[model samples]
Structure formats: structure tokens, C-alpha cells
Target: MKMKLIDRFGKRLLYGSVLTALSAVLSVYVYAQDGKAGIQEANDKVRGYFSVGCDLMYAVGAILGLIGAVRVYQKWSNGHPDTGSTAAAWFGSCVFLVIVATVLRSFFGIQQ
Candidate 1:
């Protein structure tokens, strides 16, 4: 009968809508996480690596210093007129690296 068909169609539509809404709610619950926990985890991870990062910066600075010393030595031995300026520039770069690392470490309150 036409009336029976209409009733069946209406029921199907209503059931489909309910099911869709339920699935959406369930998906949201499944995917949702504690935002504070996520942020704390990220913070802890960065803090843990902070010391290592600072150490790496120090190592880089040391390497640069050594290289600079060698270059300065070579220039001086060759009687280059700009040798003093070159030495000063290299020394400045090494010092700048050290200062930057120290500043960042202290600024972030990172431990030794």
C-alpha cells in the first residue's frame, strides 16, 4: 500500500539520521585528547633536550675557534697585512656563538 511505503521510508530516514549523529559523536570522543597533557608533554620534551642543544652549540663554537686559530696562524706566518683584522673577526665570531648560547640557555631557564 502507498501508506505503508511512506511509513517505511520515514522510519528509514529517521534511523539513518540518528545513526549518522551517533557516529559523529563517537568519532569526536575517540579523537579527542587532553590538551593540557599534550602541551606538558611537548614542554617536557623541549626542556629535556635543552641541555644537549646548549652543549652542541658550545661544541660548534669550540670547533670554530680552533679553525679560526689555524687560519690566523697561517695568515700571520705568511705576513698578511690583514692578519690582525682577520684574527679579531674570527675571535668575535667564536665569542658571539658562546654568548648567544649562554643567553638562550639562561633566558629559557634551562638547567646545566
Candidate 2:
């Protein structure tokens, strides 16, 4: 008896379908005409980004380690009951960061 507004006008699905079709067509055209230069450039960019990330991670790990050491020292001097757990948590985080950075660098074969 009553017509719903959505049934009368709903273009979301149509728009998505059109957009997806356009992207697929564009990708196919790009792959059809591509030189190795583009791939090599992309690879170099990725390696540079990864190297920068590794260096940043190392710096972060050092800062964390220093802060953790100071906190652990304060707790130990006060003879806090949870000193051991606190120290373990802080040191563990620092070690984790350093280890992850190392592992990723090796895994990616990023020579710096």
C-alpha cells in the first residue's frame, strides 16, 4: 500500500559496483604496460623505509631501557614488595622491542 523511500531511491550498491569495475579495469591496463623500473623503485623505497624504522626502534629501546633502569633502582632502594615484578616488566618490554627490531631487520634482509 505504501512505497518505501529506500526502494524508490538506493544507489549505494550501484556506486560500489561501478567503482570496483573501474578499479579492476585500471589495474589490468597498468599491468599490461609496466617496466621493471617501477618495481625496482618500489623495492628501494620499501627497503629505505624499513631501515629507518629499525633505527628508530633501536633508539626507542635504548630510551625505554634507561627509564626502566632508573625506576627499578628507585624501587629497590625503597625496598618495595613488588620491586621484582616491576623490574621484570620494564626490562622485558625493552628486550622485546630490541629483539623484534633485530628479527625483522634480518627477516627482511634489509642491509643498512
Candidate 3:
């Protein structure tokens, strides 16, 4: 007796779906953990690394300041008409970076 190919395929598909659903349901009970614990762990990790993040921001700001200084000097020496605007933009960016870092740390109450 030859089994129909389509019937065999459908039976296999049904078996696979049942197995997948069973495994997923079992896993949910096997790996259940406290949500609050997970959230607290994440909070601790972020707080631990916050100071490093702030330091990196400060370093970036310092580098930008130096680059801006050199660029402004070049523009001034070359008598570029947009020198003033360029300088203002670069200065504002550096200040913004420092301010953001400070504000975030304060807002999050993360202390060094």
C-alpha cells in the first residue's frame, strides 16, 4: 500500500508543530526567573558603568575642542567668511557633550 505524499507531509508538519509547542511550554516553566531580579541586575550593571560612560564623553569633548581650535585657527588665517559660524557650532557641540554627560549623571543619580 502506497501512502499519499501530501498526506505524509501533512502528518510530519503536524508532528513538528506539536513538538515545538510542547518544548516551548515546558521551557517556560523550567526557566522561570524573577522579573524584578533581572531588572535590578540590569540597573546595577548600568550604574556600575555609568562613570566610565561619563569619562568617555568628557574625553570626546576634549578631543573635539582641540580639533575645533585648530579648525578655527585655520579658518581665521585663511580669512574664511564662515569662520565665526563654524567656531560657534564647534564650541556649542563641545559644550553640549559635556552638559549632556553631566545632566544624565545627575538625572540618574549615578555618582562617581
Candidate 4:
């Protein structure tokens, strides 16, 4: 079991690394194009993508927070022993998602 888990992990890590490297190389190639037009095109595309991503993040965070609130309320009403930890986990994830989205937008220099 241990050996199988290790093998699976190694394979996953290798695949992830390979994909990351491939994307990096492709992005570099795209950005290396000559002329101002090429650079502006790339910048616009990236900015659009970032804007969409941030919007999606906000939607997802709102949904997650709602679900978490409901779950916590149910657990609290039921007097579950693990309710506190479960609530904490859910709230924490919701906050983290919002924070990450906000930070990414700021880091990308995106103007609302």
C-alpha cells in the first residue's frame, strides 16, 4: 500500500511539473513576439482573463460561504461536538478564497 501510494504521488508530481514547464515555455514564446502590437495583444488577453477569473472567484466564494453557513447552523442546532471545528474550517476557506481573489486582482494591477 505504501509503495503504491508513493508511486502514485511521484507520477502525479512528475505530470504536474511537466505541465507547468510546458505552460511556462509556451507563455515565454508568446511574450517574445516582436512589436508593440504583439505585447499589447498579450496584455489585453491576460487582463481579460484575470478579470473573468476574479469574478468567478467572487461567485464561488459567495456560494461556498452560504453553504458553510447553512452547514454550521445545522450542526449547531444538532449539538454536534465537532461543530466548532467544522464551522472554523468552512469560514476559513471562504475568507481565504476572498482574500486570494482580492490579492490576485491587486497584484495584477487590475483597475475596477
TM-scores for candidates 1 onward, in order: 0.69, 0.67, 0.77, 0.64
Q: What is the lDDT of candidate 2?
A: 0.89
How many clashing residue pairs, candidate 1? 0
Q: Please tell me which predicted candidate would have the highest TM-score against the true structure.
A: 3
Give the runs in model 4 whose Cα sits over 4 Å from its true position: 1-40
Q: Compose the digit string of candidate 1's lDDT tens values, residues 6-112.
A: 99999999999999999999887776667778788899999999999989989999999999999999999999999999999999998998999999999999878
| Per-residue lDDT of candidate 3, residues 1-112 (tens digit) | 2569888988999999999999999898676667678788899999999999999999999999999999999999999999999999999999999999999999999888
lDDT of 4: 0.92
- lDDT by residue for model 4 over 5-111, one digit each (tens)? 99999999999999999999999888777658887888999998998899899899999999999999999999999999999999999899999999999998997
Candidate 2, residues 32-80, lDDT tens digits: the string is 5766777888998988799899999999999999999999999999999
Sort every candidate by TM-score, greatest first.
Answer: 3, 1, 2, 4
State residue 30's C-alpha deviation in candidate 1, in Å: 7.6
lDDT of 2 at 110: 82
Residue 74 of model 4 has an lDDT of 97
| Candidate 1 off by > 4 Å | 1-32
Which one wins by lDDT: 2 or 3?
Answer: 3
Cα lDDT for residue 14, model 1?
Answer: 100
Q: Once model 2 is optimally superposed onto the true structure by TM-score, how far is the C-alpha of residue 47 displaced, in angstroms? A: 0.2
